[model samples]
Target: MTATVVVGAGISGLSAAHQLATETSDTIIVCDAAPRLGGKLHRLALDDPADLDQGPDLVDGRCGDPALPFTVDVGAESMLARRPEGLELITALGLDDHRVHPTTARAQAFLDGRITPLPPSNMGVPTDLEALGGFLSDAGLRRARAEVDHEAPALAGDVSIGSYVADRFGDEVTDRLLEPMLGGVYAGQSRRLSFEAVHPGLFAAARQGGSLLAAAQQVAAAAKRSNDQSVGSAPPVFAGLIGGVSGVITALEDDLRSRGVAIRSSTTVREIRREPGVDHGGRFTLVTGPVPAPELITADRVVLATPAAPTARLLRALAPEAATALAEIPYASMAVITFVLADAELSGSGLLVPPGELPTIKAFTYSSNKWDWIADRAAAGFGAGTAVVRASVGRFGEEQLLQVDDHELARRTLAEARAVPGWQSARPLRTRVQRWGGGLPQYLVGHRDRIQTIRSAVAAVGGIAVAGAYLDGVGLPSCIAAARRAVADL
Candidate 1:
């Protein structure tokens, strides 16, 4: 007779619901504001030619550029082959072939800005030592290099990512490394992000290295080890489905439904009221939004896995203090414009701008060169023998860009990409713009503290739990982790 209700059909929600749904003795009901699941992780067709899976890049571009002529994955291009969860999910679904490797680069973060090259290790990180070497005078380079103390600093005490980076490297390095990395990954700002939260491994490595540089390198080396394992011989990179990440969602949803899970899409949850006086258990009073209003439905437990804003709103109705902290957690807006190209000449993975080059785009996946399938499908959707390329643009909070009409946005993104080193002479066949106004959650400095406070209040208030990219971390893997643990607690 015990039932659990999960709010939001996002990856986080879906992952948590999947566990609870299949668990013995507990029936589950999942609610989402949209008419479908997948949340921000979705893909669409390119002018009806083929579906374009979009979101942050997942699959690696190692197989070949997407513009070549073959199939490419849409979801994660190349997952950490080291991690079992993603692999397990793929295997259980009979998608073992979907799993591929990647081809990494020697000179990463190669941009036209004043960024110090991300130090060796993390994909998105640039280093002050490298930057100093790249831009400073001989004396400056020598001074900075000489300061390389083999001692690693303890990253235990709390600090903001920005403060930590600036203190360890320099303001310039932090701006380039901490800023763009966070922007590219979470659309967050280091100035407001918690050091421990943003770079847990970095902090942990520092604690272990006994010196900041050594710790940074240690973290980098561990990641490097993982990456090496992912691609034993081939170049280390990845790419995914030709249509889009939506393919993955489509497959998963179909599988879940076949298993008899009730998928009530567009069923907005207006509130999640916990039963009074229940410590570990409670009844959830669910109210679908104003439209398609369903009579109140009750449940023994509730799971919240939506974005911070909406989740915060609902939680506020039940717990005020928890709501405040959740509300305070900021989000970054974004937009994606996939451009179909006229030929394979302009095909290849795109470039990542340093913090200041354009301040808008963190980077673009050269879909053509990133995947063979995408590349081989040249111009199928466009003119015969043509090509397809996607231009993803905008920083998280560029309000003006956020408000841009699709046409203008498309034009701007194409123009921006063309301005890159080699694309100066190319022309775009067509453009498709997808807007995500409040999509990315910014993990500002002290975010961990804020989340801690929110969780404490939720526990004190009644039977409730918070789960999503915001609570634990962003990205597909992280979302899955957060959801599984929350629902298991039910």
Candidate 2:
């Protein structure tokens, strides 16, 4: 049987391999440049391994207490509960029972030197103007009101979310509200992000007519009607696993192995050469090796589920047009600093900082307060006095912040935490900094058309498909859906 090769072992690649294993008779082999699986779904243990006293049972003060291992996910932390793809995969992997939802969905907005409750928003578009009087100036509120009274601008095709929103509501709304929420997810500036790609339903609503805020209200009303159904009320907005999101990776790997899928790690593919009208019709030659040694693996079908840049490089030979389009897709690097802090009264799930407000930290998650699983682990491993909090630092144009050493980054993150209420005097017991080089993909304007062109070029090459956070939505559900669709195309 001819083997099908997947060239990345991220959730997308693993999901593709798993789907192909079930749907097709073709042999599947997954390869990755990294030494371990779970590209971004990485977890770190809290206790020191070298300390003899620090075993799995290393609780801070209890001898016979439940010795649960304390681990913090440094990568993708949560999945959208409403998106069925991720949950479906979890159920298929027998991990549906381990699913968890946030205890508190509330979040704070740290802006203008104070932390206040984030008002109800439709993807960062505030529904209530009067409530926002504290944050917005009289002039800003007037501009926002003018958006509804003024005729909607003619948006023929895809446009940058920032530009469109700024034009509609004013720069204040885009910078103060939309940018933070969009930036927290994509790490890309809103001015460059595709409005259609990021917010499709809202985009459709906007196209109908009226202001952006009016569009949001209309879209939200329709959503409310849909949420009246059985499926919508079942799950929360976000959910995680009992252990960590990494559990999904482990489960996927085990399932793939059970189905006889060969997983190759620490193997980098130098190039992929498509051989047409050759032996057995056609096949792909994956030039893979560590160094000083080269190995060629032939595959009847190939899947490129890598990041934007590397994927572009691999496609340079087979499909230059696709490579060019892929090359234009840029990425942002970031660091997640996990701090073990003393138990403080931190309500709400997390806080998002407005852009240009903080130099180091962009977002903060009160892990223990947000997730019951994390809280239980913290109580079992350390005691009620201990808490877990993490701050995400770095954005698209903020590469300089990541240049400093991890120690300095952590120090800066802790200092930013002081801006949050009740965290002023909090000190971190242990600090763990995870640096992700080229972590998040930026979905700039024209991203949808570019993705279409890239897909068309790759499709012309035949027997090859590309899937990643760049093409699909930048979330676990979106990636899972993209991976499934990529494999189905074969």
lDDT of each: 0.61, 0.82
Model 1 segments more than 4 A misplaced: 47-80, 103-110, 113-119, 123-156, 207-210, 223-242, 274-280, 289-294, 343-348, 379-387, 461-463
Q: Positional deviation of 115 in candidate 1, in angstroms? A: 12
Candidate 2 residue pairs in clash (backbone atoms < 3 Å)? none
Point out where model 2 deviates above 4 Å.
Answer: 49-66, 232-234, 276-281, 290-292
Indicate which candidate wins on lDDT. Answer: 2
Per-residue accuracy of model 1 over 153-255 as CA lDDT, tens digit each? 4555767777665665556556655566666677666666777777777766654434465556667766667767777643433334344434556666776
Candidate 2: what lDDT? 0.82
Cα lDDT of candidate 1 equals 0.61
